[model samples]
Target: MILVPGLWLWRDPWLQWAAGCAGAIRAAGSQPVWFGYSRRVAWTAFLRPTGGTAAELVRRFLALYDRVRARHGPPSVIAHSFGTYLVTRALSDFEGARLRALILFGSIVSETFDWGTIVARGQVTPARMRNEVGAHAAIVRLAAALRRFGYPYGESGVTGFQLDELSRSVNVRYTGPWLADSALARYCRGVWVPLLRPTHPPRRSVLTLRSRELSRT
Candidate 1:
């Protein structure tokens, strides 16, 4: 299993998720390797007005992929939140990466997901009783439309946008702050705990580049 933790969550005291995943994989009789990316390589970076930083981060990810594949066979990748962005970018980097499985949790890829069923299940309520419309209805419509015709953000010419298509094989498991229930907590505890307690925590200063711009000042 290839575990990837979310942004800032990859930092020690926050990277418990990766360790937890590793443990789970071990318990299931499989060896897991943690694959972490810098926080600056966030999803928003891909959409920023100046996407130079995101482009550079993508290049670094490609280099990391070379090393990981050389050491480990194309393995099952598990990504959460911001790290999901990296997983998508990396998959787009190589065609024959041999991804066994992709488990995505707390997904931040789309602003809206399946909500019709969520509302029927009482997961959310209409903002105004009189309006009779869930707040996230619009986003669900957008996601539906995009999924129908493939990715909507970029054209075929775009380098990284191609990863959006891989969702078909990627097993997505979403855990929103809204879904703060016991079952959800237990399912994600493994990923969340170890990320919070790392043996060699990364320095916060290591994050010099921001997703928004190249200028640190």
Candidate 2:
């Protein structure tokens, strides 16, 4: 699985998450190959430049698509938050970069369908997290348009952009609004990580991008 973390965090974060997930898969004796990417840009990367539109962001993302595909060799991707935009854009431009599945955690996809309006709505209240919002809504819409025909977006909307197109080869899993840090740490440190190692004698394992069960949080 190609693991991509949210912005500001190093690529290792997703590996950490995957490590936690590894325990679940290992219980079934599934050999998991976790992939990582440092290209995890900040949420703002999708936003418009002084004169650019969302299209510009897509163009740039497409330009970098090859590097990612070459590294992971068409992986089952897991993207959280803003990384969803990056994954969507990559898949839109390169059909051969087929994936097995896509798991989006706590996605900010709601903003992608109508970013301008979402921004405006937030402006009314002077929110603190405003700076994190970006051109993701626009990018997601563009990707959705390219990948499929009729997917729609809205508050509490079940249909998402680009997901159906992906479903042809990649199963799309959505686990949004995930319980915040407390839940995450519990899943990570408490459960996933512990189950991966030899239990009789506790030992510290060398953590790598390779498939291995990891602790969470």
Candidate 2 similarity to native, TM-score: 0.39
Model 1, position 174: C-alpha lDDT score: 33
lDDT of 1 by residue, 1-217 (tens): 5566554532441334455445556664556666545555554553451367656655665666566657654455565544555555555444444443445453444433332333344322222101111212333343334544554222111111112332222222233232223343445345433332323433434345463355644
How high is each candidate's TM-score?
A: 0.46, 0.39
Among these predictions, the greatest lDDT belongs to 1
Residue-level lDDT tens digits of model 2 in 1-217: 3444544444455444555555444554434554333442343453322224334544554444445446534334445544555555455434544443445543445424433332243321111111122223343344334324333222111233322231222212333223233344444334323432222442434665233544332
Clashes of 2: 9
* Candidate 1 weakest ten by summed lDDT: 126-135
**TM-score (C-alpha, index-matched) for candidate 1:** 0.46
lDDT for predicted candidate 2 compared with the true structure: 0.39
Best by TM-score: 1
In candidate 1, the residue pairs with backbone N, CA or C atoms under 3 Å apart (3 or more residues apart, or in different chains) clash, namely 13-196, 14-195, 15-194, 15-195, 16-193, 16-194, 16-195, 16-196, 17-191, 17-195
